[model samples]
Target: MKFITLSNGVKMPILGYGTFTMSNDETERCVTEAIQVGYRLIDTAQAYRNEEGVGNAIVKCGVSREELFITTKIWVENAGYEKAKRSLEESLKKLQTEYIDLVLIHQAFNDYYGTWKALEEAYKSGKVRAIGVSNFYPDRFMDLVTFSEINPMINQLETHVFQQHKNDKKFLEKYGTKLEAWAPFARGSHGIFENEVLMQIAKQHNKTIGQVALRFLIQNGIIAIPKSVHKNRMEENLNIFDFSLSNENIKKIEELDLGENVFMDHENAEDIERFFKMFKIGNK
Candidate 1:
């Protein structure tokens, strides 16, 4: 379990278990298994609607609160100062913790500026250890960083071998912000599991394609949260810390970058509107 020190000097695990599409029951079981497998960080969100399960797993795992890094986000619907603050308190109750390590705005849309004000206040009050934003592009990210009282400690985006986010990483580095990857495996799209280059590299290291994909991101200094319901897959994702990829192998993986998003493109206005519409109906 390697750690990445944030701009505020908080140490976060380089790898974490993400609860994206997992059901509440599955999240509880898998999070418990992940903690048993030596995972100290767990990522969840208000939209995930499984924070209670994560909190239950933490309590049942018997790991001290200090040894764990728990993160949750404020959904777009809760993106105002009052709502965000209330939401954070609700999250704390659901998580069964007094304080949170990190709390992020789930998306850049809606009233994110107001949401950020609440987060800034929470950080100052010692309720949240660190504050950040997820799914923010460079333009919106810069706007927040320049205008806010506290610079964002992290900006999590969709990143993987295919969507490498080279330009975004450079921009984030300028503000002393760390980059976290949401879909580290690109959700196994575009035949990622069958990529010849990655498979060949896995053979050389005697590892699986998934392991190779995770290692590639970690080697590039990106924080990744890979999700899996299976305990065996959870263990496999955690086994990436033992090996190193050579410069040649790293270059080969770089060539695998397609420079485009494999999933939803937030840049499109229609896509953005459609996303918000789903949030309105609570479909996401």
Candidate 2:
């Protein structure tokens, strides 16, 4: 239940429930269970295609709208000012909310500057509380921060124990931007679940490897949105507040950083081109 104040002075939960791959039915059920488990932040994106399901759960859960921190992203296809603005309204309709706690550019590709302008306008109009970008590396992130009229308040990226984004964290700090982690568990890749170091740490703390991984990120001031469909796993992900990892344990986990992305790199030319193509077709 810890929170981080964004550059714009908005308090965001340090931990949240992400609806990335959760199906429509599963998203409704999982998000409802997550709220009952004490999660107030819910992160969804236009590309995820489950905004309605999330909205349904929010309404059915009977939680007041003001108590929940809801976030959604503008997809790449809606990159122009007009399109982005229209998409925001559409998202509002789908989410069944009058105002969004946060809205982010889902990816760095396409006319993000145009999309940013829409976000700025929306923020000023009180339709969005905060605005940001996702999957933007240090270079692009800095570029946007430098030229934009309103600085980005958050930068969501691929962050986990194996790829801590230490250098990016420093750059974001310089720009007064907060770091939010998408794949906080590394999507179970690179043997993250079975790593000896994490296993030993988990054994000592009597916690799961996933708990150790999430605790490591949150202790370092990064917001983590670990998604799970199962109610038990969702509750487990929210149970990292009791214990603290010692400095020695933190340093040991720091040594595990590989300094590279375990997921797709947005900087690669082909990858970027393909991403834009998908947006052009509005498939995602």
TM-score of each: 0.97, 0.96
Cα-based lDDT at residue 91, candidate 2: 95
Per residue, candidate 1 scores C-alpha lDDT tens digits across 138-236 of 789988988999989998998999989888898898898889999999998989899999999999999999999999988888999999888899999
Candidate 2 residue lDDT tens string, 134-234: 99987788788889999889999999998899989988888888899999999999999999999999999999999999999999999999998888999
What RMSD value applies to candidate 1?
1.7
Off by over 4 Å in 2: 273-284
Collision count for each candidate, in order: 0, 0
Poorly placed runs, candidate 1 (over 4 Å): 281-284
Q: In candidate 1, what residue range of length 10 has the lowest lDDT sum? A: 275-284
Spell out the clash pairs found in candidate 2: none
CA lDDT of each prediction against the hidden true structure:
0.91, 0.91
Cα deviation at 251, candidate 2, in Å, is 0.6
RMSD of each: 1.7, 1.8
